[model samples]
Target: MAVHLFTEWSKSPGHLDHWERTGREQGEECGLPNLGQTCYLSAVLQCLYHTLPLTHYLISQAFKEDVVKRSPSRGQVVQAAADILTEMDRGKPKKGTLAYFKGVCGRMDDLFAGSGQREAHDLLSSFLTWVHQDLSSSRNACKKCGLEPERRSTISDIFEGIHRATIICPESGAIICSIHERFWSLSLPLNNPGETPLEDALQQYYHTRAIKWYCHYCRREHLCHRQMHILFLPKVLILHLNRYNIKGSDPKLNWVTFPTEELTLDGHLTPGQKGRPWSKFSLYSICNHHGNKKRGHYTACCRSNHPQHVQTPWLFFDDEEVRPIERFKNPRDAHILFYIGVSQVQQESRQTCLASGGMGLQ
Candidate 1:
């Protein structure tokens, strides 16, 4: 849609008034996908108009056509556009809009470059927490899926839905979040940096210890597809897991699974269980394309979908200090939510930024 609009607009050599109507007609038929495409392109057009010093006719046409027509005039889309162009002098670029994009890109670059160090710092924090606490029970084993139950009972799980957890860029503190229940937890070691790099220490810890040397993707090593799996067990059983610090601000934890469409849980595990695990059992399903040659695919319960002993635990932030200003109770304390993260691509975009001169590595 953007390409089509750009092509048409670029060719139309008439006055702004003449082309404005044409673009509107085009956008009307474009549908929702086209609307998004136009908005993104409009942002770029906005940048180019200001920087390149286009003629007044061109600028006017772009705004009235791209900005005015596509904008819904009610929700955030139009409002934000209006806010950006608030101080728009006749025929000039909007100051607010330019500043907004520039700030976004600049901040993104800052985080991407410093991400490695920030992850290292987070590892230190995780290590300190692990060393300081003397857990009553260290191993809660689940024979079916080869996971430990003890680690699943941390504040991250206990207070799962209270307040949303944040998944910051670790480097820039820039945030990207998903729904609370979709977060994913991976185990990696921080204190004992035997082989893995300091930055990925925590991930390594999770892989080695929590996964029990099994591969989550292939399941050859008896590892579940994800480090964090929802298991069904009896209420009387208590889980013990290793505590790991969260990296971002988006209430959701980082984990993987395709959209719910191609994936689902078993009957017993279908209507997920809260505190009690044994009462009901559900099958955890995943669409994994990691090792397969056939693009990506979904991998469901080839084995058991229960928690294992000596598993990694989740950690939560948001005590009195991080709580919202409102007087309402923390949401995490009330609902039953899972911690999951977006896919690798989404996580990376939320995490890294690149600057012009140097290649930013995070």
Candidate 2:
């Protein structure tokens, strides 16, 4: 399959230059036409587009090379995504990339076809899997030895973590432990019945759990414990709240209070690792769902990098319409939240301002 470049559109007499100039003048608020019931996908895309590292990577030459190397025939989703990012960066009107993305998604799953409304989390998982397939690699070696190139492969380490399971024998008091790396998004359960704080939910997620198991070390049945810990911090952190309860068909609308400025993850890290003392992150975007499971609307709010704004800026994207907001007063409907490291925010802000030609403040 031949690769299609955004430059192909440059043939239309200064279209690309005009788009760039307009974007520099006005803040980027490129909208997307709703492809039937693709609001979920659109919301996910909006949040991901606001992710600085992800947006930068998608438009980078390395991403294109990786797409060609990993997915030769089925690279339309990625290609379309990149084109959308480019168009948005240039401050162009909505060109509608939903058709391309929907086509690829339908090929993967039947539920994604037509005007059927799918879960945002499910679509996000599929999209991330497709995009980050060949973006990372793993190394296998002993504690003393260095990396083993033979075991290396494409690996995205942003959401990676380790799951540790420990088994203790009741009779002999012997203990057995095992640790393994996990590459996936973290789903935090709303265990508490009433309103819960985001930090409290995270604590519950990493809290140790005891269960009955057979201990191989002492060859006897005993109690076992399992815990999860962060292996390393990623440039962008995505957290999905599991709101739907199995017992009750209704979705949990309980308020999940999350930090707007900073979230430290020092307690979740594994011991003896040389990772940062505290993984601090600042809110960048939020994917919120309104109404119930059967009928609902998906919308997203992203931190705006427009240099002209006096106060902190945020834009809410509802399908083809975009509007600015001060901040999220109520976070009850916040389903998926995106955060980036504080250290990188300043650099990204500078890039955003430079890209926009340093527009005058209002």
Q: Lowest lDDT 10-mer window, candidate 1?
A: 301-310
Candidates' C-alpha lDDT: 0.24, 0.63
- Candidate 1: what lDDT? 0.24
List clashing residue pairs in candidate 2.
136-154, 136-155, 137-155
Candidate 1 root-mean-square deviation in Å: 24.5
In model 2, which regions exceed 4 Å deviation?
1-27, 68-73, 93-96, 134-155, 163-174, 306-311, 344-362
Q: 56-157 in candidate 1: lDDT tens per residue? A: 223333333323232122122322333333323222334445445333322434431221212222222232122112111244554433433443322122
> Which regions of candidate 1 are displaced past 4 Å?
1-117, 120-133, 136-143, 146-362
Candidate 2: count the clashes: 3
Collision count for each candidate, in order: 60, 3
Q: Quote each prediction's TM-score.
A: 0.17, 0.78
Compose the digit string of candidate 2's lDDT tens values, residues 243-309.
7754564555465888765577777866665443224666778999987777798999887753222
